[model samples]
Target chain A: MIQKIMFMNGYGVFVWFSFAITFVSCAIIYIKTLRTLKKYENEYAKELNKLSVSERKIVLKKSKVASQVFASYNKSF
Target chain B: MFDLINPSRVFSWIQKLINFINSIFFVVLMIALTFALIISPPDYLQSDSVRIMYVHVPSAWIALASFTAIAFFSVLSFIFKIKNLNLISKSIAPIGLLFTFLAIITGSLWGQPTWGTWWVWDARITSMVVLSFFYIILIVIHKLIEDEDKAYKAASIVAIIGSINIPIIKYSVDWWNTLHQPQSINLLKGTSSIHSSMLLPLMLMLLVLLLYCALIFLMKYKTEIIRIKKKNIKRL
Candidate 1:
């Protein structure tokens, strides 16, 4: 209705623009986070593949330690 | 379901889906905002000045919401040591500050016509100003600390402490005699001062604003996660 259309009036520009900025900024961030997570996974895989038999064992050991540390830390929470 | 725990697949898909949904939300919000603007009528009392509430209310809501989020995330980060939580709290800081800035500016603009002054240190105004200070302090603390773990700890403390102020700010007017009008957005006010006609658009605008905040907060949190991931990789 014509009556409803006039309700927002001149203020629509400010309201909409502000909302747009916030939305776009968030979307960009979200995409970037996923990309980084993918990158990390790829890097981890490559490093694992490149390790020698003995080195692989040592690396796994370190990972076990790291996980344990993380678990203990988590428990404190 | 066990296969779904594959970090890259799971997280990337979530990211993509969230981004897609957020984009859709943005478009829908745009349509709604434009529709409201074009369709809604100006107030008889304040005329175009009433339009200010649409902007002012949303920004205030975001400012308040952001602080509340930061406080909650700070608790998570401190107790759980979740890097994601810490990053989220840090990233949301700037967005919160931005909304607070908008709220103050729109408030001043609204005040000129309604209050006969551009600025007043009324209970609401003073509390909002203090809220802005808290946002700035959070940002400053985040920046000043060199060690990430220590910084997270310190900032978490600040965030938790600052949250105590939010209730005070909300109730400041109620607790003290003030020139600032009481909550206009209240539902139980008997629809006397604000007519039913005006309330509809006002509520719609608020929803749009809240959606906007959620969109921004999600985006900022994502960016922070990426930035931290990169930082960790670089260190390795």
Candidate 2:
């Protein structure tokens, strides 16, 4: 017990306390960022889920048609 | 190869270059921490307590550096209206605050041994405490405002205005007769008091901290960018 206390030298109070604060702060930031990212990803998946398969197919076809029109326009040039 | 002939090669080369730079940063950081821990001689007076300087000083250095980044990027964002730049600066705020707090705590720990006090209102300590407060204020400003554009603008303004304190903090020892020792590391003298063994580790610690700061900043910025991109895609 004496050796341990002397090792810390009463400065252990300060040193260990600081370390604790740093550890907790880092953990909080990491956890908060993780939760935020996961929440946003889940919300995005839900939004995508709202779209019916037929609607997505229609949107895909429209984009393909638009790209083809641009390609033909380049060919005419 | 020319950009017209091999765009993908150029893209791959850029990616490779970035990866190389990141790898170099990590290697240097690891080397620095190793030097500090294993190679550096202990202080004659404080002994192992001096080791804390390895972590403490560098954290403070990077804390200041991160704010410098935020200030520069905020200015760029304001001038260019680049969404990514704004997001990157905002994302870095909390990390900078964490480092600032860590530095202060470690400094206080060092002080209990060296100065016989855990806390003091010395110029360096007080200014560092104030710097932490400024970071918190910037974060609060970002959180309080609801509109993204307006919030970014407001946060950028706060970051820029708060940056005036950075120079003051750097020069506080010189400007005022303070309990804090004058900075030992200067371009003119180049750290005269410390032995080479000690200096090497300190330098290593500094290098590692700077690279770690960059890595964390980039990681956080990338995370924010992905979030923004997803938001934009959803809008479409």
Candidate 3:
């Protein structure tokens, strides 16, 4: 039964290859996109931290995205 | 209101949505894979190779749908001058490109056992290749053009023009005597030549892929928002 499922009547190569490629590609994209998102989130937090406390406070007050990103980035770490 | 889709509003939801999808994605994928590979009945004609349709068809559908969405949003952005819509289009382009290539590759894999050849310059296949090129051009434009406004304008034009090929891709199998089969599922007419057993797996796989696309798009969109915010931090 296991062998039958794997072989798929000798067409298994094509079938498995199709499914494998589709999934592998999806995984690669997922990882790369995740990495890029994390990098940007880190940068956003880092850039905000580069400022003095007063300036950081001003930014956090003015830009909701900066504050949210900084918080999210901290959560990740 | 446009405020409904503002990045600040959307950003809050992205993480929650990502976590939600991550929680459910693997389970859905396993179900889809089981049905697609082990449970679904094989074609009377094509045999076990028909399983490829579960992936190929969904990928093709997504590729086509993504481009249509990008083109529609591009036109809307140009008319409404909505920066958010442009960001949405930019995020969608890579996803479209990835699926287009997947469709072509899997179709080729499906072809070898069934068509006796890996590939042929059939009308449908060639048009899919063309669609992929359009996706590449759209991405390249965004990356190469330094000026944000110019990139979006150029991309909008390209998207608007590239959309013309969409219908061609859809009808290519019918219009030309291509080796590719005509569309089995037609949403407008509410018809499908495919059996329910096969359709179930196809739809399940589609759900899985759609969830995956959503996860990727949200991440990319979040990155774009952060990059913009980082650039503007000093000004803020």
Candidate 4:
């Protein structure tokens, strides 16, 4: 059974290659997108931190996305 | 109505959707793999090579659908001038391009054994290549153009023009004699040449890919939102 599954009647190479490429590509893109998202979030949080406390408070209150990024970024730390 | 889609309201939903997909994605993927690689019997003619269809078909479908969506949103943005829609088209472009590349590569893999060749510039294949180039140009438009509004307009125009090739890709097999086979599943005519056993795995794999697309789109869209906010921090 193992041999049959592996060889697939001499077509295993193509079968396996197709699956491998599709999945590995998906995984790579997923990791890249995730890293980019994290980097952006971190940068956004740091930008908020550059503001004065009152200004930061005002920004956070006015912008939910800003608050979310700041809160998530701080949580990561 | 527009207020409902405002960044803040949408931001909270992105978190929920991302968490939900992350929880379910792996389980669905495992099930899909089981069906695609093991449970589903090999084709009588194509044998194990048919397994490639599980991924190839879905990738092609996603690539075509993404470009269609980008075109739709692009045209709508042109009419209504909604900046938000541009973000959606932008988020979808990379995912589409990745799938387009996958389709071509996997199709080649499937081709070598089944068709006895790596590639032929058949109508369907050539048209799909055209679609991928369009995706590349759209992404480059976004990256090269510095002005946000200008970039969006340029990308939208490119998307609209690229969309003209979409129908050509779809009907190319019928329109021209090609090594590529005609579409086996037809939702419009409610017909499928593929058997149920194969169809089940194909659908399951599609579900997995769709979930993956959603996750990526959400993350990219969220990043875009944060980017806009970050740029206008002073106003905020």
Candidate 5:
């Protein structure tokens, strides 16, 4: 069974390597998008901190709502 | 009616649904790949090399589908003047481009073994290359035009215009005598030429890929909204 899969009648190299490359590309894209979301979230949080308390409260409330939506979105994964 | 719906709440619901789908996606993908590579019997003519169809066909299908989606959103954005629709198109472009690039590379890999050449200028292949160029152009337009509204308008126009190639790519196999095979899965006739074992894995992989695309699109769209919010905050 092992040898049959490995050989694939001499077509194994092309088939397996193509799948590997495709999956790796997908993984890279997923990681990159996740990192961008994290960076922006941190930056947005820092911006919120600089505001006065009352003003920050309103802004933070809106932000919280938005983040809650995204949290659910992320949880689905 | 539009104002009555809270965008955040809708987005939250979508995210939760995506999360559920993704959990299933990974498992289905693994089983599908194993079946495609190891369990399924080889073609009588093409032999084991036929395994490449599982990946190549799905990639090509999704690439074309993604572009069609971009064009669809672009039309909605133009008619409704909705900025979010434009943003959705923007977020989808990179993913569409990735799949187009994959289709080309895998096609080449498949071609070398079956067609005796790594590259060809056939109608089907050429139109796909044009589709990739359209993806690149859309991305570049976003970067070059700084004004948010202006960039959105320009990208939408490009997406709508470039959509002309989608049909060309679809019909190219029938329109011209090419080495590329005609459609294996036909919708109008409600039948497919491929064997059941081969078709099953192909369909599963296609589903998983499409789910993957949606996951990526949501992530990018969320990032875009956050960036817009950040800009609004800075202005105040």
Candidate 6:
């Protein structure tokens, strides 16, 4: 039974290999995107940390306002 | 009801949907793979090699579908000058290219066994190659143009113009003498050449692949949005 599944009437290698490559590619893309998100989040957070207390508060406020506008725009949709 | 939804809410909703799909995508994928590989009977003519169709067909469908989607978003971005729409088009391009590449690769693999040749310059194949080139050129242009607005405009224009290839790819086998077989599944005619047993697994695989594409597109788009916002914050 195991041999039958693996050999697949002698076409097993090609069939299995194709599916493997496709799935591996999908996984790679997913991981790369996640890494990119993490990288940017770190960069942004680090930059925010560099600011003085008052400056950081002001920057955060601006971002909050921008997000509010975005939220409203989304609601309008 | 639509007015009640905001961007944050929509974003959160997409995240939730993606998470939900992610949970089930693998289970469905395994089931589909098993059905395709073992449960489905071998083709009378092609034998076990016919299993490649499950992957090849769906990837080709997605390759075409993604370009159509990119063109639609490009139009929206151009008309409304929406940065988010442009970012979406940008984010989707690489994934579209990946599908196109997979289609070509898997097609070549299947062809070598069944058609006795690994590569063919048939209408369907050539048009798919052209589609991949269009994607590469768009990516290159986006990289070369440093100005985000200019890059977006240039990419959108290219996307819209290159979209003409999509219909050609769809109709190429019909219009020309080609080794590539015509489309097996036709929704309009309510006809499919595929057996019911094989079709079920193929459809399931297609669904899983499409959900996979959606998950990737959303993740990439979210990252792009955050990256852009960070850049603006740094400038501020």
Residue runs of model 5 more than 4 Å from their true location after superposition? A62-77, B1-6, B234-236
The TM-score values for the models, in the order shown, are 0.69, 0.74, 0.98, 0.98, 0.92, 0.90
| lDDT (10s digit) by residue, model 4, range B1-236 | 76777778999899999999999999999999999988999999999889999999999999999999999999999999989999999999999999999999999998999999999999999999999999999999888999989999999999999999999999998898999999898889999999999999999999999999999999999989988888888975
What is candidate 2's CA lDDT for residue B72? 88
Clashing pairs in 5: A73-B15, A76-B19, A77-B19
Give the share of true interchain contacts found in each model: 0.05, 0.18, 0.89, 0.88, 0.54, 0.49
Error of 1 at B210 (Å): 3.1
B1-236, model 3: which lDDT tens digit per residue?
A: 89999998888788899999999999999999999999999899988999999999999999999999999999999999999999999999999999999999999999999989999999999999999999999999988999999999999999999999999999998898999988999889999999999999999999999999999999999899988888877787
lDDT of 4: 0.93
* Model 4: per-residue Cα lDDT at residue B145: 93
- Categorize the docking of model 6: acceptable
Q: Write one digit per residue (lDDT tens) for candidate 1, span B131-209.
A: 8898898888868988878888988998999899888877777898876776765545544356666666667766766
Clashes of 5: 3
Residue range B60-160, candidate 6, lDDT tens digits:
99999989999998988789777677877888899899999999999998999899999989999999999999899878988899987899999999999
lDDT of 4 at B32: 98
**Tens-digit per-residue lDDT, A1-77, candidate 1:** 55533333454444445444544554565466447544544445455545576765655454532223224334545
Local lDDT at A51 for model 3: 93
Q: Quantify how close model 2 is to the true structure by its C-alpha RMSD in Å.
A: 8.3
* Candidate 6 wrong stretches, greater than 4 Å: A58-77, B1-9, B234-236
Model 4: how far is A65 from its true place, Å? 0.7
Q: Put down candidate 6 lDDT per residue, A48-76, tens digits, no spaces.
A: 66778787677767675234334443454
Among these predicted structures, which one has the highest DockQ?
A: 3
Chain A, model 4: TM: 0.94
Candidate 3: stretches off by over 4 Å: none
